[model samples]
Target: MKRFINKWWRGRIAKLDLCPLPKALAPLENGRVLIFAPHQDDETIGCGGTLALLRKNGCEVKAVFVTDGGGAGGLPEGTVAIRKKEAAAALAVLGVDDLVFLDEPDGSFRNTLGFEQKIMAILDQFQPDWLFMPSVLDYHRDHVAIGQALYACWRRWQGTARAFFYEIWSPLPATWVVDISSVAELKRSALSRYELPLAHCDYLSASMGLAAYRGLYLSCNGQSGLAEAFVEAENNGIWSGISERMLALRIYFEKLLKR
Candidate 1:
C-alpha cells in the first residue's frame, strides 16, 4: 500500500479518465466523529469500514439514524425495532457506542417541522471534529431530506467539523476517499447484521463491491484495498452549494420518476 501511495509523491496522477484516483485518509489520532444515517443499514452500507478504521485510529465515532426504516414495503412486523437492534449490533462491530434515532417517517421525511431543529440539536450536543452525512444527490427522499435539513441547520451550527457526504442510494462524485482494506471484512460483517435489508437486497455484497471498486483509485498493481468515497463539504458555502444541487436533483428525479 505504501509503495502504491508513494506514486503520488512521484507526480503520478489520474489512473484513467473518469477515475480521478482518490487518495488515502490521514489517520486521526483523537477526535469526535458523528454520522447522520438516513436509515438503519445505510451507516453500514456507506461507511462502516471507514468507521472501523477511524476507531482503530482512536477517533470516537457516533451514529444517528434519521428514520424508523418502516417505509420499505413488505418488511415484517416490528421492523422499526428489529432494524434498530440490528444497527446497534452492526455499529458495535465498528466500535461505535453512541447511536441516536430520530424516528422520522421513512419515506415521507421532509426538511421541515423539527427536522432542522433535530439536526441542530445533535450538532450542538456532539460538537464533533468530523461529521458524516448522506450524499445530496442520493435518490432516496430521506437521504436528500437529511442533507436539506443539515443545510438549514448550518446557519446556526457552531461546530467546526469538516463534513463528508457518503454514498448510499447515490454514487458520490467523490472528492476524497479513505482506504479501508484492513477493515473491509469488518464492514461486511457489520452490514450483514442487517437481516431485514439483507433478506430483501444483497446490500452486503453490493456495498463491498462499491468499496472495492472505489479502492481501485488507490490501488496500484495489487488488490490490497477497499475504500469509501465522499464529497467533502467543509463550510457553510459548500453546504449551500450542495443544497442548490440537491434541489436540481430533486426536480430531475421527480421528472424521471414520473416518466
Candidate 2:
C-alpha cells in the first residue's frame, strides 16, 4: 500500500501544471555552497548530484555532518567512527574534499545555543553564498531540529546567504527544482559509498526514481533532466525560479493524467 501510494503520487506530480523558476536564482558560478546534513550519508542522498554539478561547474562546495549518526542501531561499539569513515568515503566519491563533522550525539540533536554556536562559527567562517539544510517538514526529530537551527541562524545573520531546504524521509513542498540529469550516475556512485546502513535499506532505487520523475517533469516543460527540488523560505532579491517550475510541473502532471 505504501508503494502504491508513492507511485500514485509520483504520477500525479508528473501531470502537475508546474511553473519552473528561472535558473538565475541558483547561479553556480561565483557561489559558495554549504550543505548541512543531519547524518553522515544524507549529503549524498539529498544533494550529491547537486554537489557533482557544482563541482563540474567549478563551484566551491563544503559539507558539514551535523551528527555522528551513532544511534541508527546495528553499530558494534565503534559505530560513530565507522560512520565517519564511511562519510569520508562517500564525499570522496562525490569529489567533495572539504568536509566537517560536528561530532554531536546522534538522535538527540537540539536547537540550543551550543549547537547554534557551532553552526554559526562555520557559517561566519565560510560565509557561504548559498546554504542547504534539511526540510523543516521532515518526519525525523533531528532533521526538523537542524532545519530550525538553520532558520534561526539565517534570521540572526539577516539572511545573508541564499537558503534552501532539501528532503529526506519527508515530503517537501517544492518551489524550485534543479536539473541534475547529467550527474545522476555520479549521485548513485556517491550514495553507494555508504555501505553500512544503506546496504540494509531500499533507498537508492526509490530515490533515483524520484529524481527521474522530477527530471521528466522538467523535460516535459522544456527544461533539463535529473533534478533536485527545494522550497524557498525567503526570497529577498533572489530571483528564484519557483513559480515557473511550479507551473511547468502542474502542466506536466495534467498531461500525464490525460495519457
Candidate 3:
C-alpha cells in the first residue's frame, strides 16, 4: 500500500508545471547569509542546494551547527566526531567553506542565556543580512529550542537581519520557495556524506520528493526540484511572505551593485 501511495505521489509531482527563477530580491554581495542548523546533517538537507546557488551567484554564506548531533542512536561512542566529519564533507559539497560548530550537547539543547550569548556573538561578528534557522514547529526539541532562541535574538537585533525558518522533521507552510531543480543532484550528493544515520536514505528521498512537490506547487519544472522553503515573520519593519525566488534575485542584484 505504501509503495502504491508513493508511486501515485511521484506521478502527480511529475505532472506539474515548472517554476521559473525570479529576479533577486535583495543585494547579497556585501550581505552575509547565516544558516543555523540544529544538527550536522540539517544544513545539507534544508539548504544545500540554496547554498550552492548562493555561492554560484557570489553570496557569502556561513553555517552554524547548533548541536554536535551526538545523540543519534545506534552509534558506538565517538559519534559526534564522526558526524562532524560527515558535516564537513557535506558542506564542502555545497560549496560552503565557512562553517561553525557550537558543539552543544546533542539532546540537551536549551534556550538559555549561554546559548543566546553564543548566537548573538556570531550575529554581531558576521552581521549577516539574511538569517536562516529551523522552524518553530519542528518535531525535534533542539530545533525548536534554537528557533525560540533565534527569535529572541532577532527581536533584540530589531530588523537588522531578515530571518527565515527552514524545515527539518516537520512540514512548514512555506511562504517562499527556492527553485532548486538545477541542483538536485548536488543536494543528494551532499546528503550522502552522512553515514551514521542508518535511515538517511529514507530521510533524503522523502525530502527530495517534498521538494519536487513544492516545485510543482510553485509551477516550477518537476524534474528541476526545489529546496529551502521559508516562513517569514514580520519583525520591526521587515516583513515575511516575500517570494523566495524574489529574495534571491534581490540579493543577486545587490551583489552586482557592490561590484
Which candidate ranks first by lDDT, i.e. highest? 1
RMSD of each: 8.0, 9.5, 12.6
lDDT of each: 0.82, 0.77, 0.75
TM-score of 2: 0.79
What would the per-residue lDDT of candidate 2 be over residues 177-217, giving only the tens digit for each residue? Answer: 78887788888988887877786787788778778766655
lDDT of 3 by residue, 17-92 (tens): 6743422222245467899999988877777877777777788899999888888456578888898889889888
**Model 1 C-alpha lDDT per residue in residues 91-182, reported as the tens digit of each score:** 99999989998898888887775777778878888888888888778888778878767655655687688788889976877878888888
User: What is the TM-score (0 to 1) of candidate 3?
Assistant: 0.76
Which regions of candidate 2 deviate over 4 angstroms?
A: 1-27, 72-74, 235-259
TM-score list, all predictions? 0.86, 0.79, 0.76
TM-score order, best first, reads 1, 2, 3
Better of 1 and 3 by TM-score: 1
Q: Between prediction 1 and prediction 2, which has the larger lDDT?
A: 1
Q: Candidate 1's C-alpha lDDT?
A: 0.82
Q: Which sections of candidate 1 miss by over 4 Å?
A: 1-20, 72-74, 220-224, 236-239
* Residue range with the least summed lDDT across 10 consecutive positions in model 1: 11-20
